[model samples]
Target: MQLKQALASAVERLDAADVGSPRMNAEVLLLFVIGADRAYLYAHPERELTSEEAARYEEVLAQRATGMPSQYITGHQEFWGLDFVVSPAVLIPRPETEHLVEAVLELARGVQRPKLVDVGTGSGCIALALAHELPDAEVYAVDLSAEALEIARANAARLQLDKRVRFLQCNVLDPVWEKTPDVIPSEDFSPSRGTCCSEFRDFDFVVSNPPYVAFSEADKVQKSVREFEPTMAVFAGLHGIDVIVPLVEQAHLALKPGGWLALEMGYSMREEVVNLLSPTMWEDIRVVPDLQGIPRVVAARKQ
Candidate 1:
């Protein structure tokens, strides 16, 4: 079968299965199966696929039809103009999260050798991007799930940023947690063992794209996300503040005076998330909306 015919068939199947962006999904999966770019696909539409290639295309199309995210099938996603490795173990990095990164960069402006931490760094997109942009900064990424950390570490190595960031397995900023040993530690990295919030403090910025979806709102989430993505990386709790509450508390404790905390939240979470940042402890609180005008990032400066 020709590339065009296979793509048409895949698109029809995906559309029938009620997948969003069926054509785009079909094209991505086809490109993955054939190991070709969109340019090649267009330039060689009439080219015939071998039996193995056709079978592989059918396999991936079936996966997409079942609502498995294309990023998982491709094992890659682009964030902040950088390619990242992703999997079912981690939440797929979204474009909206880039706003969170931008908000942190704005907060870090003019701060020399700023120390930063990324909570719930599923794919390490935020931490690595910050490291890439701020070559002199100290960056750390922490996640509750060891499986997710594996993928994040892999992405760091893939981006040739293995030495630029530290990965730790911890929930929020738990007082006692050990750093993942695979990642090379910086010369100034202290403790080299389990540590407390005392050692985690004095950051110039604490940023995250944490799980903000509440369990009650599970029905509102897309089927693919609810079904295929890691549950810990999706739902926070009954009120969706289970993760955010502690994250806010730890960020407040971990940040130096005047340090900033930036977070990416759900469309409905601006008010609730903002409320978590107390007026007595946090100031200059602001909500940053995405291109669609949804409140995507909430940032606050420590008082």
Candidate 2:
């Protein structure tokens, strides 16, 4: 079949399956199969698809028709202008999360050689992006699931940022508090560093795009997210603050005086998340809105 004919057929198939952005989905999947760019798709309308290419295009279109995200089918996604490898193990990085990165960059500008940790660092998008921007900063990424960590680590290596960030597998900040030999080498520590916990408490920033969707609101999520993405990276609990509550406490314990904590939240979580940061423990609390003017990121400084 010709390129234009296959694309038209795929778009029709996706639209019939009720897929959103059927044309875009068809174009992306087709481009992925042919290993070409959007310009090639339009310029080579008469180009014939090889037998293998046609079959592969059909396979991916079928996946999309079943509510599988195009990113998962292509095994890739772009964030902060950097391409990242994604799988079922990790949540596909969203564009809005870039606001959380911008928040940290703005606050960390004055700090020299800042230390930052990304909590629940799925795909290592925020951590790697920070490392890419703040060349002198020491960045660490932690996640509970080893599978997610594997994908995150691969993205780091692929981006040639493997040496820039440390990938740790543990529950939240637990690995940072423990005196693990593999986590923090002895030579990396300073004599003035206090207790085991204190040794890792001088982070200038803590950033996250954690799971903020409440279990009760699961039905409200997109079919692709609810069905394809990792569950731990989406739903928090009954109230959606289950992860953020401890995350705030951990950020407080992990950050140095005046260090900042930035997190990406749901559209309606501005008030609830702000309430989690106690006045005594937090100050300069600010909520950042996305391009849509919806409350998206909430950042605060440790008191």
Candidate 3:
């Protein structure tokens, strides 16, 4: 079969399955199988596919038909114009998260070598991106899952950002208070080890796209997300503030006076997130909309 014919068939199948952006998905899959760019595929529409190549194309087609995300099948995702390796271990970086980065950069302006922490740093997307843009900044990322952290570490190495970004395995839900002088402990403690009391110090900035999907809204999510993506990165709680509530409080405690806190939240979560911030802790609280004009990012400053 010719490459063009195989691509057409794959796209048709995806369309039949009601998959959005079928043509784009088909083209990406074809490029993956043929190891060629879009130009090559267009210039050689009549090129014949070997039996092995045809079989591989069919396999990818089947996966896509089942509603698996294209990025997961391709093992890579683009965020902030840079490609990062992705897998089932980590949530695929979404375009909406770019706004969070932009908001952070806007706040980072004029700040010298700012210290930033990305809580629940899945795939290290936010932390690594910030480190790349702000080479002098001290960036630290933490996640509860070791498997997710492994992928994050690998991506940092791939982007040659291993030296700038640090990864730690941490469960943000657990009480972080260690028996020490500081408010937030500077030293890392193993979860297996007994908890200690340490003062948690303030950070220059704190940013996150923590899990905010409500349990009741699960049916509204797409199959690719609900099934393939990790639940730890998705569903929050009955009110979807399981992570957001604590994260906001933590950011408030972790940020130095006047430090900024920016977060990406669900479309229907703007008001709820705003309410999450107390007047005494956060000032200038506002929700920013994304390209789709949905209120997605909430930004504020510590008082």
Candidate 4:
């Protein structure tokens, strides 16, 4: 079939499926199938697809019609201007999460060879991105799901950042300790914290884009997001701050005296997060908004 005609049909099908960004999705999938770029599509509007290419494009379109994310179909997503391999095993990296990386880079600017850790580092996007940008820094990525860690490891290797970041399959930063207990210790550590837990200490920063969607809010997400993406990477608990609440305490214990903790939080939970990082344990608390001025990132320095 001719390129223009095929794309027209694909768009109509996607629109009927109620897929968002139908035209753009159709064009991207077609381009992916034909091994061509958007400019080439315009220049060769009369181009005819080979039988195999036509079949493959149709298959992708059918998949999209079911609300499978295009990123999963293409096995890739772009974040911080870099293309990342993505799959159902890991959360597809979002553009908003780039702000997490930006906030980290900005805070770590003056720190030399900083020790950094990313909690719940699903695709290793935040950690790998930081390691790529800060070659001298020591980077650690932690996740609870082995499948997710595998994806993260694959991405690190694909980006030629394999040696730059360490991947650990554990619950958050708990693996960093010398002898991490089964349960997370109390927030108000006894100063003898390291004696019972990890000896790893003095992190320059602990960053994360943790799960912030509540179970009840799950239905509010797109069908693809709810059905395809890893659920633990999306939903936290009843309040969606299940992870964030603990993260604030963990980050404080994990960072150096003046180190920073940066997190990408839900826009509506800004005040709750701010309250979590009260003046006693945290200082220099800042909430960074994305392009739309939504409070997207909450950063604080350990006092």
Candidate 5:
């Protein structure tokens, strides 16, 4: 079939399946199948689809109809102007997380070779992006799931940042000092570093987009996210602060004196997050809004 005809049919199918933004999704899927950009797709609407290309398009459309994210179907996502490989193992990079990266880069400008760590570095998006922009810094990433780390490692290599960013299989909730003494020490560890059940330690800056969606809010997420993405990367406890609270308390101990901790929270949890951290432990605790003007990132400095 002609490319235009196939594109029209795909859009109709997606619409009937209740996929939001059907036309745009169809265009993007077509671009992926044909290995062409939007402009190319438009310019060559009459171009005939080979049998293999048609088959691939059909397969992708089928997945899309089931609410699988387009990025996962395409096996790639673009963030901060760079492309990263994505899979079901990791959370797809979101535009809102760009604010976290920007805030970190802005703060790192004056520091030399700043030691930075990304907690819950799903797909190593934030860590790799920071390392790519700040080549002088020592960037480290940690995630609890090994499968997620595999995708993250592949993404780092694809971006040629393997040497700059390091990925470790570790849980941020556990006290890291006992397991990784070389990085964090027991004596230097602060009492406020969460429950101190896990060991790990000092970084110049700590940033994360930890799981903040409450279990009750799961059904409210877009079908593309709730149905296909990993749930471990999405929902937290009843208040959605189960992870964030521990991270905030521990991040204070993990960061160097005056170092910054940047966190991405649910749009409505800014005030609660600010109130959770003690003023004595973190100075200049404030929330920054995302591009949509919703309060999204909360940043503070270790005193």
Candidate 6:
């Protein structure tokens, strides 16, 4: 079938399923199936798709119709203007999280070879972005799920960033509670490997887009997100501060004096994040708003 006809059929199915942005979703799935870009699709609307291509397109459309995220279907997402591999094992990188990256860059402004840690580094988005921008900086990415860490490590390899950002499996950058992985004992990264101490110490920055969506607010989340995305990457206890609070404290221990912590929080989390950093131990705290003018990132420095 022609690309246009297949796309139209997919859009109709997705729309009937009550999916938002059906046309774009359909186009993405079709392009993914046919291995073509939007320009190619438009330039060759009458081009025929082979039987296998048509079948693949319809299969992805069916998944989208069932509320599966298009990103998950494509196994890819664009973050920091770079394509990242994604799966149900990790949270899909969102645009707002880029603000977290921006905040870190602004704060890290003139520092050379700064050391940074990304806690809850699902898909290694924040750490990879930072390492790309600051090639000389030491970047460490940690996550609780070993599965998520594997995908993150794979993404780093795909992007030629694996050599810069090291990946670890730990919750919130806490002291390694368990034994070390095979990568331990390397001088440059021994601490992140597993020492069970303040091995993560003295980082110039700590950044994260931690789980900030409250479980009670599940109804506000989109159908695809609730059903298809990983839940641990979304809900953070009742108030959503469950993870952020601990991350803030850990950022304190890991950061050197004058180091900064940059975090992306829920739109409703500005006050709580502010209060959490209100203590004298933290200073230069500031809130950054996204394009929508909602408070999307909060940055604070260790005192």
Which candidate has the highest lDDT of all?
Answer: 2
RMSD of each: 3.2, 3.1, 3.6, 4.7, 4.9, 2.8
**All models: lDDT?**
0.87, 0.88, 0.84, 0.86, 0.84, 0.85
Candidate 2 lDDT (Cα, 0 to 1) = 0.88
Model 1 Cα lDDT, one tens digit per residue, 171-274: 78774234433433333345664343456878899899888889999999888899999999999998788999989987887889999999998988888888
Of 3 and 6, the candidate ahead on lDDT is: 6
Model 4 misplaced stretches (Cα beyond 4 Å): 176-178, 181-199
Instruction: Report how far residue 117 has shifted in candidate 2, in Å.
Output: 0.2
Give residue 157's lDDT in candidate 2 (0 to 100). Answer: 90
- Comparison by lDDT, 1 against 3, better one: 1
- lDDT per residue for candidate 3 within 38-74, as digits (tens), equals 9999999999999988999989989998999988888
TM-score of each: 0.93, 0.93, 0.92, 0.92, 0.91, 0.93
Better of 2 and 3 by TM-score: 2
lDDT of 5 by residue, 1-303 (tens): 999999999999999999989999999999999998988878888999999999999999999999888888888898999998899999999989999999999888899989888999998899999999998998878777778888988888899998787666666635444454324322223566443334245678999999999988877888778878898898888778888887887787778799999989998997899998788788988788987899988889899
* Cα lDDT tens digits for candidate 4, 194-227: 4324534689999999999988887788778899
Q: List the residue pairs that clash in candidate 6.
A: none
Q: List candidate 1 segments past 4 Å from native.
A: 176-197
Clashes of each: 0, 0, 16, 3, 9, 0
Say which prediction, candidate 1 or candidate 6, comes out ahead on lDDT.
1
Whichever of 2 and 6 has more lDDT, that candidate is 2
How does residue 245 of candidate 3 score in lDDT? 86
**Which pairs clash in the backbone of model 1?**
none
Off by over 4 Å in 5: 173-175, 179-200
